[model samples]
Target: MTEVLLEAQSLKKHFPVTAGFILARTVSSIKAVDGVSFIIRQGETLSLVGESGCGKTTTAKMILLLEDPTMGSILFRGKDLQRLTPAEMKEYRASVQAVFQDPWSSLNPRLRVGSIIGEPLVVNRALPSKAIQEQVRELLLQVGLRPDHDDLYPHEFSGGQRQRIAIARALSLKPALIVLDEPVSALDVSIRAQIMNLLKDLQHQYGLGYLLIAHNLATVRYMSHRVAVMYLGKIVETAQTKQLFSHPQHPYTRALISAALRSRPDTQDEEIVLPGEVPSPLDPPPGCSFHPRCSNALPLCSKTTPVPREQERGHWVACHLAETLTVATRATISAEERP
Candidate 1:
């Protein structure tokens, strides 16, 4: 079995909504990330997929320790992060890194590529200036950029190259885990594949674990070892990539897959158009938060919270009717149309 690099157990983060500007009182709380849990194993890519504002990024933030969780715990190799000393926390910081959605904003415009990539080393004061430069050059080369291009500023490079530079910086720390927050979404479709391939190659070479937050199903399908689908600040489904793609048990998961398949002109699968807007996190609907948008929602779904069940081997679903839905869905689909 693969070693677990990082684990988030029932992690929760709630942002207070203040009514008044000065001497404000707490009106309500936005449940940004409510009880999300998962683990990333060595060299594995675990993807968190959901619609915008579904708390995927919030979950990543908690994992990176950028925002303190309102409740629950984060463990790095079975060691609780909250218990770490200052020095140990600093070390932990070095062990985990992140690459954000926009490379243009993430990379420093004024700095040369080499300066940007080597900044981590410079800040940590881990290596001499000459060694840092050498390391930057090697990292650039590893990410498929020419080592000599390090002198160029962010503006001089194309979007794809800028993203590669960002990636190189994240790699500079030799991190065990990387939280990639929509890393390839801002790039051109053509460049997205290249970046995805590079990430996979890097993971294989370094035995790095990745917590990928992405909306692109094709990219998720190609990159992820395991996948967790989120709905209204909660994880609704989780399974191995093959299992989830082949047989999604939750209504939301099936809908997402249907939509993804519809995007391909080649596939003729009927699109599952979910009705109703996502409920506000500040005032989420009772019971299953996704009940308002769920097609197979039962009366009980609205009154009782569903527990995640292992409906199949390693495939978990949080829904009142997952088993019934799975059986009905399978009975309707011909083997030829299944993706």
Candidate 2:
């Protein structure tokens, strides 16, 4: 069995709304990440997939310790992050890194690529000036960029090149875990594949664990070892990539897969369009938050929130009808397989 590198137990992040000028009375809160829990095994990639505003980004931020959790705990290698002191937190920062969505916005426009990548070493005072330059050059080459290209500014590089520079910088400290928040979403489709391949190669080479937060199911399918599907502010389903794709028990997961299947021009499948827009987090639906949009919703689904339960080996789903759905799905697959 693989050792767990990072574990989140009911991790929650809520943003408070304030009203009034002088008193600043607190209004309702927006529960961005409400009770999310998962474990990332060492050298494995866990992809969190969902629609926009579904708390994927919020969860990523919490893992990076950028956004403090409103409730619950984050344990990295059995050490609770909230217990770290100011200086210890600084050291912790060096062990975790992030690659944001937009390469253009993340990179410093004025600084040369070498300086940007070397900044982490300078901040930690880890190496001499000459060594910093050498390390930066080596990192650039590792990410498939020419070592000499390090002297060029961000504007001189293309979008893919800029993202490579960003990735090289993130790897400068040799972090154990990386939180990739839609790392390839902003790039061109052609360029996306190259970055994905690079990420895969890097993970194999370094034994790095990753928390990949993205809305693209296709991309998630290609890169993830395991996948967690989120809706509103909660995780609705989680399973190994092949298991989730083959037998998605949750209604939301089924819809997402249907959508992905429909995207292919050769597919003659019907799309599963959910009714109504996502409800506001501040005023989430009572009982099951997803009941309003779920196609197979029942009376109990609206009156009682379903907790995640194991439906099969290593597969967990949060839904009142998951067992029934699993049987129905198997019957359907059996029918399709008939000659």
- Quantify all predictions' global Cα lDDT against the true fold: 0.91, 0.90
TM-score of 1: 0.96
Q: Count the backbone clashes (under 3 Å) in each candidate.
A: 0, 0
Q: Model 1, residue 23: displacement in angstroms?
A: 2.5
Best by lDDT: 1
Error in Å for residue 145 of model 1? 1.3
Candidate 2 matches the true fold with a TM-score of 0.96
TM-score of each: 0.96, 0.96
Candidate 1 overall Cα lDDT vs. reference? 0.91
Clashing pairs in 1: none
Model 1 off-target regions past 4 Å? 261-266, 333-339
Per-residue C-alpha lDDT of model 2 across residues 1-339, encoded as one tens digit per residue: 878888999999999999999999888899999999999998999999998899999998888877889999988788888887888788778878999999989998989888999999999866789999999989999999999998889999888988899999999999888888999999999999999999999999999999998888889989999999998899999999999998788998988888775465786765788888888988889888999998888899988989999988879999999999889978988999999
